[model samples]
Target: MLLDEASIRRESEHVEDHIKRWMTVEGHFRILTALSTQMTQDAISVAKTSPLVSELYGRLLTGSALLQLAQSPIDRVQCSLDHSGTAGTLLADVWPGPCVRGRVEHAQSTQAPLYGGDGNIHVSRQPARGGELYQSVSPMHASSVAGALQHFTMESEQVITFISLATVVDDDGQVTMSGGLFVQALPGMTDEDLSKIKGCLAQAEFEDLVVAGDHPFDASAAIFNDVDWIETGTDPILYRCRCSKQAAVGAVRTLSSDELAAVRAGATETVTCEFCGTDYIVSAVDLDAS
Candidate 1:
């Protein structure tokens, strides 16, 4: 699907404005993130219908646009995910600073050792290696997106982070859309300051705003109330895959000669990317040349 760049830009600006407002009250480094419903639904649909993807079920799509206050204007970070079921897994990539790239997997079986009443979440920094395990501690004996994300924040060692997430699914079990709000206090923040920030977050009517389809900035404003904020800049968030045909072929070439020959002998050889559900067909001629 084609993205309306103008619309995305407007939404991004709205989120950034909220972050700036929050920063005025806290007066320190912070990261604020939000996602649109359309972006979330599209991701969930891909995960549910893609022939090559199967890790998530009964899932929701979540998107995030991160705005960090710094000396160099605003540092933007984007995150998107399609996850579901009692237990699931995720792969992510990490960049410099607080931006992380990796996967999160929730254990499917309630009987699993690591299963907390909710689910067992496995976060892998390396896609090849499994990941560190985090068990949920939901008092109500149910799994929740917000709960899972809170676990992630603690495990990742982000001090003083507040997250508000909500999802809407149609009766037919299709996700209509999803969105969230995230705020994090940077290091060196005093406990007193953190407590005040948390107080503001606690009083914010996040669920109501989200349900009403309010802009993310509005939610931030509710949390910061009357604080004067500056407008930095905006950035777009998109769901895209980095897979390429050449990358697929390169992977096939890594196999032993015998394995390569076996693949070439088949009527059709194909490789599918688990991340984006993209298929790449392998050619016998290409295999022979390698």
Candidate 2:
């Protein structure tokens, strides 16, 4: 599963809709995410470097982000799952600005034995700059995180969404293609329109979709049907961070100069951004001003 730039560009064009976009179609759209994981000896394998499990976790987060965006229009959200059943918990965050960042706690182990266990999924919303965050949790029923998320949406949010996510990584550890779709039923929507939505979802080239590795696949005509729908445009989603060295310096400034000196001398002042894997280091000179 070797991921290619062209294929990614194609997929990035329209296969999935983000939170901001989902909000625009509040009354008519639904979310859908699925994956193409093949099992070996009863254990699922992603065929890529980053386990398929991690990708599924991400899709779930993406769906949660969209759902949260619809409910809390002003704030950005982050969804996390503590499926300690397998690995440690999984975390994912997305902003209305449409920014996304996430990762796994322990992604190395091949498998974590859990004959049959349930897990928890949490959704949190934090303000634009900063403010009190809100959270909601639900129990997982299926082995697949996506399935559990769908259940959560239905039971908690009372929204009907369908997600289809797939990941095809090769033996070489390259993710040939990975993406999903989110389609929801709008209130007061007609059955004919709903049927059209289903038709589009069904017509999708699932096999070529994952193998083709198209990100932004077209959903304009397929999902919308006769219902009045609009393209929310591309709110490019990516792995990012909101940390800075200057911010770190400002924090050191709050401390006494002596404290700054100690931190610099130890060369122990480090700020790491969980979203983008960026590390900011505070050096002796940096603390001298303090």
Candidate 3:
């Protein structure tokens, strides 16, 4: 759902972490700006990832949130990256609540650049009303999650999209800032108009946007100071997991029967939610009841 200008202003002022969306008066450029400080902190706290992985995870979360803005309010979006590198894989989900959750696996090297590996970006959208799932995968840009995501959207959705993402973490392994912006060429967009947006982004740069101010207004005004645009919607970026005790136990049941028997022999099996790090137990009684 789209928020009115009043809600947009209220949310932007009250929420430190949220995504703000807009379209140009010319109807040629669709834009989204995100600031995800609290969201990143929540994800990092749950993952307990190394500083490098935390940064990568934060970017993935931001990317997912941006993509979600393109979806109908009822839809949910998920993005994943699997690489042939020591850095490992990343997964993130964004839903109608504007909340995000994710996980990273097989991180063999904290120093390993998130790039320099054969990797693919996979994306999918789930219809809230229940329907066939939409999925696509594209080669990774490797340079950054934002690059890969931009490539994926352009190639898979066949739209010209310019995206830039960034994550900043302190020496204490705390995420101080995390977010980015994307300008997508709409149906009526002309090459010149697209170029203008690109040029604006090039001049503004992600660094300057944040340096001047990380607020949505500050960044949007910095990048499109002379342009006319109206707020389309705004939603707070929250970190919430869908994991439940039943879902957790159901996951444990997915193990092979032999494995299940062995786990049940212990009388209790602990299952951890990958997204939020919550734990659930499957006792012998639970198995017998099942």
Best by lDDT: 3
Model 2 backbone overlap count: 33
What's the candidate order when arranged by decreasing TM-score?
3, 2, 1
**lDDT of each structure?**
0.46, 0.54, 0.78
- The C-alpha stretches of model 1 lying farther than 4 A from their native spots are 1-22, 29-31, 49-118, 126-143, 172-177, 231-233, 262-267, 288-290
User: On residues 62-181, what C-alpha lDDT tens digit does candidate 2 reach at each position?
Assistant: 555445444564677777777755556766666664555555655554575421166787777778778997778888775665566667667776766665555555655444444455
Best by TM-score: 3
What candidate 2 gets wrong by more than 4 Å, as runs, is: 1-27, 30-49, 68-74, 112-116, 190-232, 250-261, 264-268, 275-278, 288-290
Per-residue lDDT of 191-254 in model 1, one digit per residue for the tens? 7766766677768656457557665555666766644444444433434455787788888888
Looking at model 2, report the run of 10 residues with the lowest lDDT sum. Answer: 35-44
Better of 1 and 3 by lDDT: 3
Clashing pairs in model 3, backbone N/Cα/C closer than 3 A: none
Error of 2 at 78 (Å): 1.1
lDDT of 3 by residue, 259-290 (tens): 78887688567898777778898875666665
Per-candidate count of clashing residue pairs (backbone under 3 Å): 17, 33, 0
